[model samples]
Target: MKQDVDSAKAVMRELFAPTPLQHNLFLSDKYGARIFLKREDLSPVRSYKIRGAFNFFRKALAADDPAERFVCASAGNHAQGFAFVCRHFKKPGVVFMPVTTPPQKIDKTKAFGGDFIDVRLHGDIFDECYAAAKAHSKETGALMVPPFDHPDIIEGQATVAAEILDQLPGDANPDLFIIPVGGGGLSAGMTGYLGGRIGNESFVFCEPEGAPSLKESLTAGKRIKLDQVDNFVDGAAVAEIGSRNFDALKSFAADQVMLIAENAVCVTISELLNVEGVVLEPAGALAIAALEEMDRQSIAGKTVIVIVSGGNFDFERLPDVKERAMRHSGLKKYFILRMAQRPGALRDFLNMLGPEDDIARFEYLKKSARNFGSVLIGIETKRPENFDALTGAFDDAGLRYEDITDNEVLASLII
Candidate 1:
């Protein structure tokens, strides 16, 4: 398996150099551990997805009577990777993406493939788009290059683990590894390559709290398909772990996997961008975010490696990201306030705000009401404790209000 991975890496060298494995000072200091980041985000496609796509194509082409074309379905990183490899191999391919996929991703995927691939906008969700790609593959006899789940794709992803072993400085060994899970390609690949070589205790898996397919499957002792999935962490929002990938991970106990909140992931993404000047998509930040949930004593003085999966973030979503981060950090909140429909009502509410508190949003939700009107308000503060003071003032002033910050349904409908 190592030799096969080495061969894959050798072939990949023709496309891009191995991504850097750098020691992150800020994280190391904060976590009390020697923390290194496997910068897969620095790949040519800004993701490790390129590895699987390229290796899958390479093996298919080498086989006798290989399909003349290829097809894949992905809304983000994988689509870009598949497109990139198609262009590199000069092979005609088709990529199906969800119609709701951000334009930035769509444009980048098209740019990477150039004339080698055609981008098709399909259904609004990934499963629907994937179905369309499968239909196309069946009709045209084009090879289906799955994002994960195949042997070749898993082998290709395993190259990342191979690189890690070679890149560690001065024969130093890592005590822990943080890997993010989606369809489980990277986790499965890395474990398959390092399972016997390294102790299983060294591995720590992370998944979005909204999509715990891998954890749920491990608990059930089988692959379990989720009825619904949250797409906020688009890169890791998988409804089911791939069958082949699960085989590689099934031995692990369910407790080994940690569920990271989508909002908490946004906080990590924001911190990395603001403090470290490093941009990472939500999934890319998962491994790092999981560190916040770990007991510092467990990792103190130990060496840890976190795989940063991808950095294909669209700037257009920065505001949304910041909003989520602020909400998660308790620095921002939304509320529905009952305002007296009379003079000085607005001034009364304004006076209740603390000096550090600033109104970010305010609108009269129901002005037609006779005596009292519903006011939708959003507030931002410098610290989490500031909310206590502000709420106390509101109570003292007899201001009728309900905090909707943690109310997902209300926040979604109004804020």
Candidate 2:
């Protein structure tokens, strides 16, 4: 373990220095506890992924008969890291990404690898791209640089834990460490290293509720592939936890893993962006959101470290981020209302709104050949309690409505 850590440090130094471990005064004051952020966002790739990528590249290159070609499938930070490492090691790489991947990510991956990496836009989903990447590797005899799962990658990621220990004052360990899990490389690596060194420190793993890969895997006592996944939080929206990662994390108590709602994570993204001018991608905000579910008493005075995984946020999606945040915070809601087609009916409904209520959206879904029109109404309010008041008003006014906020199918289509 010590030799592996030393190797990772030596390899990492060849590229860049360690990411900052800065104390977050704002968060500390807000939570009434000492809070520190492991600024993986400051890495050369703007993510800790480079650590694993470099480690994998170093180990592979050091082999007596190393493969000259490296391949990987990713549309996010991992692709960029892999590309960078391939270029750094003077190895050719083919990065397969879903065609639906944002152009920004594609450009970044290319920029990082220069001429050494080839970006292939494959199928519409990650699974499709992953299959293509694997098949390509088998056919071309190139080494597949797995995003996580691989021992070399895990060892590389474990360097983050070592850095945290070194960065702490007098080798002081954090009382609690909150880590975001995707394919589980980062979580598995940190836990494997830290669990070995400081067996007593508490660790909380955070995953998107829509893609609870790690949580589900642990519960099933095996790595189970999810049939469907919500990719809103793309960084941590893995359908299955990596097999190797699951092996490291499977022993953890179920309560140690926290599943955060996709929209709820958006709230943290917005908060960090607006308050601290810190741009955190959805997955990057996972660890911070877990703080809300934690027992205040348990973390009251303890030093806590939250890994801010990445900041490769696309600002063009700001409106979508704001919408999700509002919904999660209960400041916004959607409902299907049956409104009478009378002239004064709309006016009456508008008058029913409370002082703090505002209508953000009002669309007529259907009105042809009907006495009552189907209206899709979205409302925003200063407080969540305002929804109760609004509902009471609807009852008194003889308006019929159905809240479709929790209906995944209905909300996906219209909300």
Candidate 3:
């Protein structure tokens, strides 16, 4: 396995340089640990997916005819990587993406593959798109490249660990490694190599909270498929762990994996962007978010490594990211209020708010009767405690309101 990874690394160097490993000062002081980040976000395709795609294509070509066509299904990083691989080898390839996939990703994939690829917008989500791609592959006799779940893909991704060991300074083995899991190719590959080289060094896996497939599967002693998955963390939102990946990872206990909330991940992305001028997609910041959830005392003096998975973030989504971060930090909230229909009702409510509080949204939902009206309001404040005072003032003024911040159903419908 190690030799195969070394050979993959050699092939990678012929195409692009290995990503950098650098120490993070801000995170180190916050946790009192030496933290390093393996910046796979800096790869030519802005993700580690290209490594797997290129390896699969190379190996497949070597085993057959170079004239064979390739096909894959993805709506995120994998699509772009596969497209770039097709361009690199000058082979014709077909990429299937969800019809609802963002235009930015679609454009980038088209830009990467240029004339070497054909893209089709199928179903509404990845599973549907994947099914369609499989059907197409069968009909046309084109080779199907899975996102993860194959031995070749795992071997290709192991090159990341090989590079990390080669890139680190002399005798500076990290005591802990924080890796992010999506389809599990990257984590599976790295864990296999590091288990032998570092022998018993601590490893922590990070996943989107809404889709804890790997964690649940490990706990159940077998593969477990999630009935529903939240797609907010698009890159890391997978319904099930790949069989091959689970085999490589099954040795670890369930507690070793940590789930990060979608909103909290948004906070990490915002902080890294505002503080360090570093832009990371949600899945890319998973390893960093895990740092905040760790038992800090246990890692006080140890060396830590976090993998930054990708940076292909769309700037157009910045406003939504900021909103999620604010909500997670308790700096913003939404409410439903019953107020008198008179003109002075809004003014009275405004006067009850604390000095630091500002109204971010105010909309008249409807009038329940001739005298009372329903209103949707969003507020922003400097601190969470200000809300305690503001709500107190609301009670003192006899204002009727419901805090809908944590009510997902109500919030989803109105906010």
Model 2 Cα shift for residue 89 (angstroms):
2.2
lDDT of 2 by residue, 302-335 (tens): 8999999998899898999999899889899999
Q: Per-residue lDDT tens digits of candidate 3, residues 1-415?
A: 8888899899888779999998889999999998989999999899999999999989998884653898999998999999999999999999999999899999999999999989999998788999999999999999999998998899888888899888888867688889899889998999987777665448889999999999999999999999999887888999999999999999998999999999999999999999999999999988899898888998998889899999999999899899989998999989889999888887888888888999999988995568998889999999988889988998898889999988889878888
On lDDT, the leading prediction is 1
lDDT of 1 at 163: 92
RMSD of 2: 1.7
Could you say which candidate leads in TM-score? 1
**Model 1 CA deviation exceeding 4 Å by range:** none
- Per-prediction TM-score, please? 0.97, 0.96, 0.96
Alpha carbon deviation, residue 402, candidate 1 (Å) = 0.9
Off by over 4 Å in 3: 64-67, 199-201
Model 3 TM-score (2 dp): 0.96
- Total colliding residue pairs, candidate 1: 0
Extract clashing residue pairs from model 3: none
